[model samples]
Target: MNASTFTTRFRAAMMPTVPSPLAMLSHGKGARVWDVEGTEYLDFLGGIAVNALGHAHPVFTRAVSAQAERLAHISNYFASEPELALAERLTRLTGGDAVYFTNSGTEAIEAAVKLARRTGRPRILSLTGSFHGRTMGALSLTGKPVLQDPFRPLLPGVEQIAPTIAALEKALADDVAALVVEPIQGEAGVVDLPDGYLAAARELTSRHGALLILDEIQTGIGRTGDWFVYQAEGVLPPGAAPDAVALAKGLGGGFPIGALVGFGAAAQLLQPGQHGSTYGGNPLATAVAGAVLAEIEDAGLVANAALRGAELRAAIAGMASPLVAELSGRGLLIGVVLTRPVAKEIVAAAQERGLIVNAAAESRVRLAPPLIIGDAEVAEFTEKFAAALAAVAASTPTGATA
Candidate 1:
């Protein structure tokens, strides 16, 4: 269907909560998509960082195709082999005891949050500027109130703490259940907690009888230089791993999958029937996720993300354009914060020049190209991005706030 037709159908058939422009879609394939009019552009956004191997990878296409042919879904009434296999892979990757799959990252967070609260505690703490899914339970743990205000009286007993030992200590209480934080805050313009931040959080949470919940949905499964950023950071802090980790985004590659993993005693916290989902642990999604995991390992996409991401950051930082004030993030998730709020305009401009990027916030642009993106794509984006920024600069004052 054309973008306009789908857009019209969306207006008629779907909820009106999300913005209109976000509803438009046409077609997608590895790092590229075409609008309704058949306009082609590089897909650096990667379905908001969901495209692990990029669009239309033969393996992804074949995996989904084979699964659909074998069995599209089984309603979670029976155990699925593909799902179990995927779970085993995840458990191995996580170095954890048990795992529960979910339809999306928010649901994964919901499972984690509920498991934390089931401990008979009344309080849980998450960091500010974190974006968990929009479900009521997931939304409850989310720190952004603007997104949650419309649906009031959220899952209560949530307290937000800054990224500091002192703040975490102050928020910890006798009745606290868990503390949730993103290794690198993705939605908040890709802001990262400073070094040793996670290590310290683990220590304090342990000291206070609270569970440490690390949201790696955006940063896990080889999106960052590591399979799980917390795993890499765990060694830095010289301590044990986090109690629970929520992973999604790149886990399923382009398929819909998310996981909530718990280690040791925390793994036993989520007993059978305590939580479940219809579409979760299906053969299709898990098989695709397993394929993605295999690809990441076989192709070394994680190391690719690491080295290529460094090259990208260096290129962005090296650009003499006065618009670029700073650069941050690891792996393929790079954030280019401009001096002004011209992020949206820059993204639009990049698209016009045959590139795709995202304006994460008003002031920053987040580029999450597929992990398999190569030097060719990166080089093209580098030149085109410079041209786009120069175009913006030429049209406006040099030091004008973006």
Candidate 2:
């Protein structure tokens, strides 16, 4: 069917919770995707940063096929080799003692919530402008009121504080169970926390005996040039570590998977009967995720992410578009600040010019191309994005603000 036909069908059948599909994508390769009508576009959003290895990489394909033929699901009642191996790999990467598998980032946050509750504390804290997830527990932790207002009466004792050391210091106490934060606020226009804020958080949480949970769902799996942003240099103080972490997004490289890694004491919080998932840790998902992570490590994609990210940022800055304000974020996760609140217009223009990106906010454009992106992809993106910026700048009125 044509893209328009599919869009109509999608809107008719789908709930109103989310907007209709932008286009009916047929397939993708490396860092590009094609719509059903055969229009090709450079994909910088990378399925919202879930397509770590890009679309249909040979490694991902082979692993899925092989694992499907061997085994897919055996339920949590029985263990599998892939499941065990992935668990071990995750622990090693995060320096955590245990892992709890889930189907999405929000589920991972829910697991973290239960862990905090296990501490017998009454309060759980999350930073303002943080986006955890959409589930009840996660939504409660999310600081955006627009998302939480409809789902009122959220999980109690969850409060949002400004992303500052002083705010955290004021909120943290013996009654506080955990403080959840994102290294870079992806939803809040890819905003970065204050310098040494994480180190200070670690010290303060430790003093109050509260768990410091890093929500690295969007930044994990080498998206930000490291396995997790917490591992990035200068993020945490020397010899300091978070009590737990929530991971997803790029973890399965486009497949659905999430995990909560608990370190040291936090590892023992969730008892066996406390949490479980029928599809969690299944062979197929875990096997595919294992393959994705393996390819990322073996191919040196982590280092590639670091290198490519810097190059991409330079290319964008070199354009010197008047509408371009500045850039934020590290590695492949980038945010382009615009002089005007024309991000949506830029996205539409870019899509028309065979490029795909998204607006993180009214004035901020988010770019999350695959780690495998190289010179050709960057050049293509630069050309199309420049055209997009020009198109929007021509149409937007002066002094536009969101």
Candidate 3:
């Protein structure tokens, strides 16, 4: 069926929780996708940073198929080889001692919430401009009110503070269980934390006897040119590591998977019968994630993400457009700040020009293209993005600000 027919069916059958369909995508390969009508577009958004290897990667395909044929689901009662291997890999990558798998990023956050609760402390602290997830526990920890207001009476003992050392120092105490933070706040216009903020947070949280959890759902799995942002140089001081980390998005590439890795004493937070998931660590999902991570390592895509990201940033800056305010974020994750609140307009213009991007906020356009993108993808992106910016600038009135 055509995209229009699917759209009609979608609106009729689906709940109104989210907006109507943009386009009914048919298939994708690498960083490009096609609609039902066979129109192609460059997928700069990369499924909101979930498609680390892009769509339909050979490694992903082979892993899923082969694993399905061998062993798909054995439940938590029986341990699988893939599950154990993936767990070992994740713990090693994050320098953690243990792992708990889940089905999505929010689930990982939920697990983290439980871990914090196990500390026997009264409160959990997050930043004001943070976005953790939408589940009750994760949503409660999320700083934005718009997303949390509807679901009032959310999990108690959760509070938010400004993303600064001063704010954290004032808010933290012996009563606080954990402080959850993102290395780079993806949902908040891809905002980065202040320099040395993580290190200082580590010191303060340690002194206060609180767990410092890093939510790397969007920034982990080589998205920021490192296995995880905490491992990135200058992000955290030497020998400093988060007590626990929440991971998802790119972990299974395009597949659905999430994990919580805990370090030191935090690793033993969840005792038996405290929490469980029916399909959390299934063999199929673990096998796919294991393959995806391995391919990312073998292909040196982490280095590619770092190099290509730098090149893309340079090229965008070279445009020197009056509308361009500045660039935020690092590696494949990028945010284009505009002088005016025309991010939605820019997104529409780019879509019309056969490119895909996301308006992270009123004045910010986010780009998270596939990690495998090379010079060709970067060139195409800059050309189309330049045109889109020009189109928006031409349409907007002067002296506009947001």
For model 1, residues 80-195, the per-residue Cα lDDT tens digits are 88988888988898888788989889889999998898778999898878888889988887778888899998887887777676787687876889998888888988887877
* Per-model root-mean-square deviation over C-alphas: 2.0, 1.0, 0.9
Q: Write the per-residue lDDT of candidate 3 for residues 70-139, one digit (tens) a residue.
A: 9999888889999999999998888999999999999999999999999999899999989999999999
Candidates by TM-score, descending order:
3, 2, 1
Q: Which scores higher on TM-score, 1 or 2? A: 2
Q: Sort by lDDT, best first: what order?
A: 3, 2, 1
**How high is each candidate's TM-score?**
0.95, 0.98, 0.99
lDDT of each: 0.84, 0.92, 0.93
Candidate 3, residue 373: lDDT: 97
- Between prediction 1 and prediction 2, the one with superior lDDT is 2
Better of 1 and 3 by lDDT: 3
With a 3 Å backbone cut-off (N, CA, C), the pairs that clash in candidate 2 are: none
lDDT of 1: 0.84
